[model samples]
Target: LKPLGFEGGPELVCQSLAEGPFGIESQADVDSVAMPLRKLVEGDNSSAAFVIACYSDPGLQVCREGTDRPVFGIAECGVLTALARAETFGVIAIAQRSIPRHMRYLRQMGLTERLAGERPLNMSVAET
Candidate 1:
């Protein structure tokens, strides 16, 4: 836009609010979190895409279901885009307490074999 000489409107970037309504007690906070995203998309109120940034890839599946607008989660998008652009790719996540869960996600996404190898960062999610 800057190069095109078009000025942009105000922007909003909220984070760490997946639990907006459901919180941890619901154990499904993504459900609540996805509402605002879906509304903006469905209502045609968003000027740009939405990005969810939890390692869990919260609300990812349903968000796609709920909106036609593009949706992305950091880790999920990285791996998927990599696979789309390459024959193989590796995941370099911190080899911490979260390894099992990440491996499970890869298996679900059918990208386990894409893993050439792993270089454990050896830092726990909390530690990081």
Candidate 2:
């Protein structure tokens, strides 16, 4: 990230929620992380930018509302980047249950027309 001109480099933060499901395979799983994630980001005062890390980006909208700092979601970034380089692109996901959320996000971005396909690896979040 430093080479990309992110001064001081980027910090990577991991979320290990004890109360939620281990893998984000469903909307419920995604919702389970939202508040916790929002709280985590809200408490942090020093980050110049925050990347949600998860492809599902559970709390992205809520988190963004809580901070003035730029917030990025890995899945959104990947898809947008791909769109910039290709007319259409496919997504490789960790679980089938996540596809709907991805689709919804794409639709919200008004980028579904650029999606070619979405394929799942049938793996848990921990495995992949």
Candidate No. with top lDDT? 2
**Candidate 2 off by > 4 Å:** 1-15, 122-128
**Candidate closest to the true structure, highest TM-score:** 2
Query: Residues 43-120, candidate 1, lDDT per residue (tens digit)?
Result: 655546667666556668777787766778887888878888998886655434456667777888888888775444
lDDT of each: 0.63, 0.82
lDDT of model number 1? 0.63
For each of the candidates, give the backbone clash count.
0, 0
- Model 2, span 46-120: residue lDDT tens: 887888778888889999998898989998898889988989988888877788888998899898888887878
Model 2: C-alpha RMSD to truth?
5.1
The TM-score measured for candidate 1 stands at 0.58
